[model samples]
Target: MTSGVIRRVLLSVGVIGTGQWLLSDVVHVPGGGLGVAAVAGLWWLSRSPKQPRFREPASLKGWIERCELVLNQFEELEVVLELQGLRSPREKELRRIEGFDVPLSVGVVATEGSGVPATVQLQQALAGAASLDLCLANPLPVTSTSWSWPDDLQELDVLLHVLPLPLRAADLLWLDQLPADRPVWLLLRSSVDRSAEDHLEALRCQLPERWHQCLLPWSGEAIELRGVLQPVRQQLMRAERVREGTRQRLLNNLHRRWQADLETLRRERFRLLLQRSQWIVAGVVIASPVPSVDLLAVAVGNGLMVKEMATIWSCPWSSEVLQVVARQLGSAALAQGVVELSGQALLGLAKLDGASWIAAGAMQGLSAAYLTRVVGVSMADWMALNAGVAEPDLEELKRQAPLLVARAAEQERLNLAGFAQQAHEWIQERNSCTPA
Candidate 1:
């Protein structure tokens, strides 16, 4: 237990020390006194001999009950089977009453002059699969442009293109003309001497970026083909469930709730990391001697924090969007005089007698740090409310910004004091090390 505490302390000190070095040396922050001081204080606290409290584990009965509850909620949806070849006339009669819900109609297009025996074997294997409704289109000659699909082909949910090992130019052109909206799967015949790498490279060079994702190599074996087609089968099953009127609405609600729960868990886990990052940024900002550039530093640091929070919430906003949000939040803080109030509070807490410029710098740094924390918290709340649903309302966020800033100021006051103590300790350590 003693060794574990020592190890953790050492790790913490190392990380903070490295960050300090990077800020001073790489970023070339003028004076770097505040950052160095912050690092030293953090190091001393980390080295302290206090034993951390251990969290208690949940009871076994409670765990078992939770598991049972989850199991009860699990509903098994219908599975769609992938049938390969042409449906036999007799099976067509049986399919009408099989009670399988809207099985995806799959059309297999085998290019002419390709491996006929291998294609035939693949088709046969697919037809034999339990629940799939497969339609094997008539083989088209390499140059034929007038070939028409079967009248029933319009109902196909997916198209599987089976091509020879090295795709011909004509084959590529034909593939380009296929409907873009529907899912398409490309299967290439396996070569005896050539590796999968060679086959992938050949396709990558000729195919568009969109088509690259759909390419798969086929060895003409039933078991292998079944494994490769699993994703397509899953998609078909999902589509069938969506088409079922009442069940579709229930499924959609359940899916949304499940996603929301996942997002909540992720946000909880990331909140700790985000708080730690904000503390570090606060310390760094407080150390900056230049008042003019302090806000810029704060914006950059908080912009990164917003980006990370967006990723945690699975929000698809771009980096530019996040940066804009951070900037707007910062501007709001400035306009509302939140920064000035925070600076005044920090100055009162520090009670440091120094050059007017040094005091001014300290105030600016503390204010920037305070505003950054407020922005981070407000953005996180906004993202949580809109996760996987809709765009965040900037006006709503702006309206709530002042209240968030006030709350953050109260919370950050305690945090800033703790940070100042650490920074003071770091400064003392540096003084002792200096040759007197």
Candidate 2:
């Protein structure tokens, strides 16, 4: 009992210390340490003096209904029907040979004795989401090496590992043997002594960071199943979406016209990532003391952005390919005098005194960053136009680069001041960490 109290105190101290550090060191908030200390004190004061009371668990039917509603929220029924061509008579007849088998096959493995009953309960609860085939597996011992599946089980889409409450590090080793191709979901069942939340935290500590999203806590009671089924339903829906997307990609590959919609979706999805990369690259460039290395840094940053953009667009990614693209784009920008114009615009904004080398470097960095954004945007457009084609036309890209840079400059003019301020703070923080 004394040790528990001591541990709690130590944990509280650690949390408070970490909070203070983030507020003061990372965020640079004024008087952040004292503010965090006060907040911690208030939290400590707010702790309930009375002990928690136990209540009767809800009925199984109530839990089942709640889980059903949660699953309904995912709209799996509508999606499954559409994906399997079951919506209309014509489509249904066409898909008759395919049948209405669940697109995803989920395998449920119970780690402990209690886990077996919990798995059965979960399977019963999920019966309403008829789009998924939930097969409950034999309770596998933690040490078991040769695991067998049901003869009817052809392929497992997702693995649902059911664990008893108060999970240990040893039990998580079972995850190592599971198929890596499929996603793994951990259904944590609470024991009589421990609550579901307690089990969840224990399991979370034992599980790898990647599996954290897959963890779901459930008490044996039906009422708790609603919460547990939410993540499970989401996982199943996500898997279905992935399958549908793959089918779409294959169809697009067969037909050229279908590629337009896929390309547009890819652009929309990766636009924010590209924008963020531009800002990060710009900040890093501005922080560097030397102006001569700006071109090299911008080239490297643009190359990395191209690689990410390629992955998002489902295009082949190679460092060599990015290097060739970057060189062509950089040469065009320089020849068209876009780089020099951007530098002048940034210099005008900074309006720094001649003595300030720091301000001068910042101006160069900001210009390089703006030019990088232009290059990235132009590359995305070129990729979209030449989707599934080999090489980009250097002449056409060169013609478009200046126009794109001018348009980007106009669109981003208002945000530049705010962005520069943020970049300055970032540079300050970065420089403080550098060793002398």
Candidate 3:
């Protein structure tokens, strides 16, 4: 509250107390004091800050219902799963065709003598996973488990896990094609006659290098192996590009959808800031010419500030525009016969006066025609006279430094005569206002 209001409140309280004492017969000093204390205590209590209360999370049923609703919107999806287990060489080969059959479905079953049952453990461990995969756990006390096609469990892809058997023989007998691409990982039990090293060495000589095979130890319930599906770098690059495109599209859609909603616009703006502020502005600051100039100044300042934040030493700006300006400075230094000074030094010199190097650089890169369209001048008149050029037309190069640079480059190339005319007009206008 304002001090005036506080003073008025105090004065009002005093007036009321005095009025009660003078006009009322029952007004006692102790009662009046007690009343005033009570009022003060109430006011203090009312002015205390309040804490916000949190609401409980939505129910599981509600979440599930929402997920179901979303899923209903989609018409098609594909789900695939692969399982690996420990078994005999012959058994593995026999089941290989079945495991690698059409649509590539497999549920690997571990043999009892294969120890620990790696496949079963993996199934039990990942039971609560949010995936479409369903692992059928095979327990110990080995018995011949046949692949059954049950009507109720038609979706389940079954495989009797075993070791290496002849691929041609298995294919001939099963009359099925194997998934040549996917790999089969082996779980080595301690009970095996040969060490895993021996098996791997023998297999390495027979199999192609492209076929990925890893040996994992079966220790009780755990089957451990370190492996990776070799990454496709080209595919990853494409995927990143796709992801960036998707992010941009999503942002564009959201901005369009909520441009008028204040809360949404605020959130979008904040998100854009987080994303390096490359969002498309709906002409928020540049509605008027004066404000447009001011907005440009602020943008330039922010760019410089961002550059300053990146450098260890105090430098003016490191943005692309400033680098252009730095190049110009270097060129100017070179023209002045100071060839010993580096480009970096020239850039530093430009920044020393608190002038925006980026803006200067922007000026450097512009062509005469573009400068005419934007700032109406060339930089040829601003720079020292060039050899074999007509006294550097001062009338045609009357714009600001950056614009002059652009126009000068354009004039050198002679891209547009109309722009030269416009520059002449601007120069004449300036000359007309000058004192004799």
Candidate 1 per-residue lDDT, tens place, 295-333, comes to 543443453466677766666665545555555566666
Question: Distance (Å) between predicted and true CA of 268, model 1?
Answer: 4.1
- The predicted structure with the larger TM-score, 2 or 3, is 2
From the highest TM-score down, the ranking of the candidates is 1, 2, 3
Best by TM-score: 1
* Per-residue lDDT over 1-436 for candidate 2, one digit per residue giving the tens place of the 0 to 100 score: 3664454344444434444554455445555453344234323322333322222113333323333332232233236234332224432322332232346667777665544545466666565554666677766665555554333432455667777667654455666555443467777767778776676676667666777787777666776675667766665666655444333322222223323534555656566766566555554444433354335334445534777777655444344444555555655556566557666665665543333326445556556666676667666766666544334454565577566545555555556665555555655655575456
lDDT of 1 at 237: 64
State every prediction's TM-score relative to the real structure. 0.38, 0.36, 0.20
Candidate 1 — number of clashing residue pairs?
7
lDDT values for all models: 0.54, 0.53, 0.30
Which tens-of-lDDT digit does each residue in 1-436 have in candidate 3? 7664464345335433433342232222233442243234223322423322222113333323322322221111111112122113323332332233233123443433333344455554333322324344353222223323223222333232333322223322221223332223434343346665565565556555543344333333242321211122122234333333333332322222222222222233232232221110111111112211222212322232223322211122223323333223323322332212222233444443333324332212112112112211121123222111112232333324445444444443353344333323433443354346
lDDT score of residue 127 within candidate 1: 52
lDDT (C-alpha) at residue 206 in model 1 = 86
- In model 1, pairs of residues that clash are 40-426, 41-426, 83-126, 83-132, 84-126, 84-127, 85-127
